[model samples]
Target: MDRRTACLHQANAFREKALADPEHHDQWIDEAIKWLERAMEASCRAVITMEGDDGSDAPAPAFETMAPHRRVIVRQ
Candidate 1:
């Protein structure tokens, strides 16, 4: 399974554990939350991985070149 799927599975596992061990339910839920965060981060990385991106040192955007005093116009 991919990283995101794996993380999601771990989250579910922790959630089940929380139900089983009521005394440590808070700790188990906290573990589940951490796993969910990993899942989110994995999904975000997948989305950010664009086609033709070879991890090259790319040039900065035009706005960065402008003076700090100037207002930048961002185009969608």
Candidate 2:
């Protein structure tokens, strides 16, 4: 098979293995979703500069602005 197809097949096989472990299943799924979302976001960002240099090197959304959508979990 071609290199890309082979890589995809290997990734699918690994994902299947992860899904078989119930204890880690949900966490793995959440991480997979996050990675996919990041990939999509990066692709879109590549199409255009989101904003002109607004003076600061910080993210457009201030930390407070994103607080509402943030997820926090305290582990023992």
Query: lDDT per residue, candidate 1, 1-76, as tens digits?
Result: 9998999999999999999999999999999999998887766541222233566677533322322333434344
Candidate 1 residue-wise lDDT at 59: 50
Highest-scoring model, lDDT: 1
Instruction: State which candidate has the highest TM-score.
Output: 1
Residue pairs whose backbone atoms clash in candidate 2:
none
Off by over 4 Å in 1: 47-76
User: What lDDT does each candidate get?
Assistant: 0.74, 0.49
What's the number of clashes in each of the models?
0, 0
TM-score of 2: 0.38
Worst 10 residues of 1 by lDDT: 60-69
Error of 1 at 5 (Å): 0.1
